[model samples]
Target: MKLKCVAIDDEPLALELVAKFISQTAFLELVSTFENAIEALSFLNQEEVHLVFLDIQMPDLSGMELARILDGKQGKFKPRIIFTTAYNHFAIEGYKVEALDYLLKPFSYEEFFKSATKAFQFFEEKENHLSANIASPSEYIFLKVEYQLIKILLKDIQVIEAYKDYVKVHLQGKTSPILSLTSLKNMEEMLPNDRFMRVHRSFIIGLDHIDAVVRNTVHIGDTVITVSENYKESFMDFLNKWIA
Candidate 1:
């Protein structure tokens, strides 16, 4: 899905550069550009935009103030914001408004792309109405990433690894795992109990995908996951069933 976005910067050159970068990116669609924050606010009130590339310091109304105003509103929908600023001091303030990322002035296209990718993921998750926990069961699960819904077959899943707040879903025949904004515990509850099992706090493996179990480790695909003591009793019970 293409994320509709607007660029707000007092500097004409910076605004143009961001517009060009947005145009070059396949998932972003530039809706408008504003030199004044007040005008941008007015336009936002009259239109629906999924994301905004906003400049922190602007005439009439500063981006910080504008962001505060938007955040104060109690609503189900709000645009994902990415702040562009010359000052690094406002980074913490940007977080208060829940900005997706901060792009310092003199940033290259590579930097812009990285921030834009994050914004895209946010919009994808928001639009899909996805939460940290799965609410239902199905044959396929939807993962929001890079402004797209990646459909992964449940049967194809081999392993799941917890990375901070995100989970990496390793699939059969795929070298790279799919990453999504969710916790390992949340995923453990969502997956079918008969098909999947949690062997460690940070790891969940498909029961059918386990190739071998050696000592305290379980092998699936090319990866090895340790069976923690907390879950070892149940894991051993299952392992004993197959050991004729």
Candidate 2:
């Protein structure tokens, strides 16, 4: 499928370059273009975009600020951002926010394709792996419940939250309460990495059930789970892969 995208740059030339590059790519669709972040935001709200070609310097709002604002929203629907900037100094900050890729100003189409290729590969690999995992799940697993063994479907679990000796099992049915258990490691071992990730020591979330993530908190509907610094890398990988 062609990746849906939008380009945002206050500089008309920069916007034109990105637009041209996107037009040249058969796998990418240039859904919209804007001279300002606000217009871009409005376009985004009205349509679904897989990726955004964003410039760091803009009059009303910087691309970094727009990324932060987008990340702050609810649900599992945050768009993957690719930052394009004149300054090389923002690379660190761009990556800090888990940007898909960074493009330097006056970059070649080859370089742009290189970054876009990485994003495409990352998403393709994730989808293939998730599809495989979902199709061939571990047949059954037992959750140790103090004195009894509770059997559950691997697909039915939304995620797990840990507290001291107890781990909460968020399941897939309507109005299902969290199942309490004492072993986080044991539960984690039973789950497949393609389907689950430990985003924090306190929370092991299902990749499928993650609705959205903002800042340090991950959202699954009305619930919010804190993301720890220690697990950020794994969490980001999961976010990219899972969201893909």
Candidate 3:
């Protein structure tokens, strides 16, 4: 099924690029484009959209504000948001808003497609409830280790560390970590968001395995991973929900 989408950007070129990219993707259909956030929000109230291509900086209402407004609305349809911004500073803010992904300015079609594909996977999993239940204790993931496909239980994961093009999967009660040829971003997308979170650019720690949060550091076993400024807000948001 084609995902109904909309593009909102003050910049003409950016809006044009998003619209063009949506048109090229077989699974996405560009329903409309809005230069202002108010008009976009008005449209959202009247219609159901599956995905949004939003530019962060705008004249009247910023993309961040629009996302927060949508989040506040109690509804059955909240469009998956992909933020587009020239400044890399807003990345953490995007995460705090639970944005599907963020596209840095001057992004190529390849980058756009990668983020779009992540959105597709998310919606597909949501539509199929069984696949989306990664939080189940019986859930196991097959990872390529050496020449073998090793099945690892989701509940046994302690931490996942990214090393260049590869990732080291550390497990609880296990001395040896599984090494696989995969990007941390790709792995993060597969894991349940409520269970695993990216504290740093290189680290994705299991929430259950975390021993403590001292300032900006997350203590999982003896490893002290610093939660970078970019992700601290979202990580703290997660902590806030369970603190009481």
Top candidate (lDDT): 3
Candidate 3 lDDT, tens digit per residue, 1-244?
7899999999998899999999999999999999999999999989999999999899889999999887666766788789988999997677656688889999999999998888887777556544445454437676655423467788999999998668999999999888886789979988988899998999999999989989889998888999999999999899999796
Q: After superposition, how far is residue 85 of candidate 3 from its true place, in Å?
A: 1.0
RMSD (Cα, Å) of model 3 = 10.9
Global CA lDDT computed for model 2: 0.78
What candidate 1 gets wrong by more than 4 Å, as runs, is 131-244
Clashing pairs in 1: none
Local distance difference test scores for all models: 0.85, 0.78, 0.86
Q: lDDT score, residue 194, model 1? A: 86
Error of 3 at 234 (Å): 31
Cα error, candidate 3, residue 170 (Å): 14
RMSD of each: 8.0, 15.5, 10.9
Residue pairs whose backbone atoms clash in candidate 3: none
lDDT of 3 at 18: 92
- How far out, in Å, is residue 75 in model 3? 2.1
- Between candidates 1 and 2, the one scoring higher on lDDT is 1
